[model samples]
Target chain A: MSAHATTEHAYVPGEIAKPNTAWIWKTFWVLVIITAIEFAIAFALTSPDWRTFRNSIFIVLTILKAFFIVGEFMHLKHEVKSLIWTVLIPTSLLVWLVVALVTEGSFIGETLSHMFSS
Target chain B: MAHSTTLESSSTPIYADAPRTGTWDGGNEPFKASYGKLMMWFFLLSDAFTFGAFLTAYGMIRHKHGVFVGTADKFFFSTAHWPIPEKVFNGFPGLHGMDLPLAFVALMTMILIFSSVTMVLAVEAGHRMDKADVQKWLLWTILFGAMFLSSQAWEWSHFIGGSEKGLLMADGSVMHGANLATNEYGPPLFADLFFFITGFHGTHVFSGVCLLVWCFIATTNGTFEKRGHYEMVEKIGLYWHFVDLVWVFVFTFFYLV
Candidate 1:
């Protein structure tokens, strides 16, 4: 504890911070636009095939929105690259795992029904 | 009942940060993250896994049920495809008996996403060292967050109060509200999972609001200004944004999909 120096009297600059009010507004608008598309798709679609297509679109848009919120709103984009990957790679694995498990689970359900129902 | 007794003068292994060797060697963050930020990121990752498990289980069960069979005439009252999330969460506030179909939750999602924007604005204000603006944005963020929690409370009440008397279950039995043994909505697991996942996410939002309250107070009290930086606000912003991100997934799985 004694080894650490105090930062109470640390340097201060007159510029404060690089105020990018424009960028923040852009991010807010992009999120709204994506959500607008999601609502539109939700109300407009009807058939099962189109339902599947709409589901894919919703998932893609969601991932896109998640990307923006995590990268920009959370400021992970400004952080060092290594730190960003440290969070992203494991999360990708998580998504893959969910997909694999759900697929296997559905197959098992089908197999079990075939075995017993007959 | 939840509290545990503290041990007398504990040290070494239980208290140690680890051996401090190799890639994670002594004092250096090679990752360039502060202790607080690194810990929050790891916590969020673990939490992501927990939510992942819940949603995956939901997918498996709902898929097993196949396409919805029941009539869509009565809609929310009559049972349909258990996998059909849009049918399940079709209630709207104030205007009861109207089949708005995901409209209420759509509003909830917008409320949450807007709060995330406010939180980001607060962080931006913090960056510029504008305490007044930071306080203003934090206040708005907290208000929106609380508004969301109240909306969730209303939704829960409507869910628990369910279809006046009761709805018909898969086995033709009538079940009311929800419990471990019975569920009016498809399988018993349906109601159970809804309560658990949304309940868990709701708990996090509640805590995030509390955190915002603290940050708001600290900012107003001139703590960040005195400290010469608003790193604390940034840390909490990460947390706030994470809560919003998880909700997006929950909304997709529970409502849209």
Candidate 2:
């Protein structure tokens, strides 16, 4: 209501007063580049020694992609620090959950292997 | 004396200095955010946890199966019996005779990512208040989303129905498609996990598509124009991107890993 009088003469129906599209394009390109890297990692590394390394790289790349989507596309990147932390801080614990569960699950596999072989 | 005082207060008008009974006091905007967008953010945060738990369970079980070595059986699924993600996901669409591996899924991912890009453009248009532009970009986004959903359905059917030769596992057993019990892939657990994770993600894609359609109608039909704001476009854009974001992880953990 306060804005109604100030912009009465300049008001336009279909556009922001000033538009910026560069960031959207930049984000799109970044996602493409990361996905390309993912494909490269998928087929290029074939050795068992490389398996763990490759998987870690993929996880990192996946996180990077998520960052762009959340930060740029979702516009959280521009939001205030409180809004950003409200999101990122607690989700960090979820990452811990990933680490803990994988470790325990590996132990279960090892136990099963021992039981079956014996 | 207290009853008499209350009667006096009512008669004299306790709130006489202030106006009463109109609209809400709305509440604080700590981050200069709107109520709707903040709620959406919180909703997305809770959703992240749900997907996180599912992926964690996946990580746990697959780790137990052991890390993948080159051959299908040793780490993946040998007669030794552990599942390899790549082996199970190796099917290519239409080109049945050859194993194109992750090619088809990669294509699906591209479609989804591209759809996300289009959605961003639509929101951009909305920002400009360009109704025609918003409609055009939104239609494209909806198209891509629909394509993705249809392709997913085809992929699901092919997996469930399987191929004529069936999957020849490292165990020397031939299995067809997947079931709750077992499939040629690896263990019954592998089948269960695949169904659960992908199915959950697919449902989100389906919902996003529906949201896209609604947005398209609202954009073309002057809904936002009437309100004098395009925040709805921005809100749905948040959701569309989230769907794509989740798929990025799914593609990594389920297919790539």
Candidate 3:
């Protein structure tokens, strides 16, 4: 069979079409806007409690950016549902692991600090 | 009559050299089964584990060492007493007397991020069978990767070259201001961990540059024309994006946190 013939056999259900450039461009601009906001939060904010506020915002925005890249740019949305879930499930688990480990580790360190210093 | 027919069929024995009808080969799922792309995914998965292990080690070390003196308490509710990332990374040639905070490293981050964008564009172009766009974007990606690597090298040299005061030593190992064996910028294990982790990442980037160069050459020579597809570009895209994603974690854990 010809190379083009294989498109008919693709595991994906929808038409295996190229992504819309205009939509991609729009998404890119949105990502840029979000990044700019992140920089502003990191640099411009001067509140005594800014770190907590900024960190929360940063994490949320980063997740959003990652979702866009994976779902849209990488065309994971068009793939078989099983494949999407297979990738996403593990990724989510890993993210959770990183957060938990880092937080717990910090707490332990803090406790150690108090123990040694006192 | 049935016996006679069977005897004739057996006598007319099929040739051993005849090809099978449903054999697995190049034609099976041709569009989606590019070897290069498959290899890329495998490479990415392995690379992800490496980064995971490094970050986990970092966490373990941080757990033991506690936080840096100026960073831990001062960094939570307020950014006030936080150890400035910029102050730690402000070295640049011809920019003497200027105290730039994380400026160069930030630029390097942008370079890697933008390179990822270009890599995706190249993959997209490949899908459209636009060889020219593939070549163009691949070249851009290569340039970005090279630039980022150079920036990282400079950062490392600045770090190891030491400041005017030099690294304070106690008991023959570098000690922080508080006279503690380790402080939050990560334990002494931190300096070692940082070098190893980033060095491994830099090696990947260097390899990526080589791959991009190869891909560029292949595109120019119309290798995909005969094959009638661009799966190689997609494969490389996976590797490039993985690098960028790893950096996001590094920036957060090592710099922000």
Q: lDDT: which candidate is best?
A: 2
Candidate 2 structure quality by residue, lDDT tens digits, B159-189: 7776566667657778777788767656677
Write candidate 3's Cα lDDT for B69-132 as tens digits.
4432254211112344544666675686576655676677778778878888888777767667
Top TM-score prediction, candidate number: 2
The lDDT-based order of candidates, best leading, equals: 2, 1, 3
What i-RMS does each candidate reach, in Å? 3.8, 3.4, 5.3
| Backbone clashes in model 2, listed as residue pairs | A14-B128, A14-B129, A14-B130, A15-B128, A15-B129, A16-B128, B73-B77, B73-B78, B76-B82
TM-score of chain A of 2: 0.82
User: Model-by-model lDDT, in order?
Assistant: 0.78, 0.79, 0.65
RMSD of each: 7.5, 5.2, 7.3
Error of 1 at B155 (Å): 1.0
- TM-score for candidate 3, please give it: 0.75
Q: Candidate 1 residues B1-91, lDDT tens each?
A: 1112233244533335333433433545566666777788889889888888888888777766556544444445333346366666778
DockQ of each: 0.42, 0.53, 0.24
Worst 10 residues of 3 chain A by lDDT: A5-14
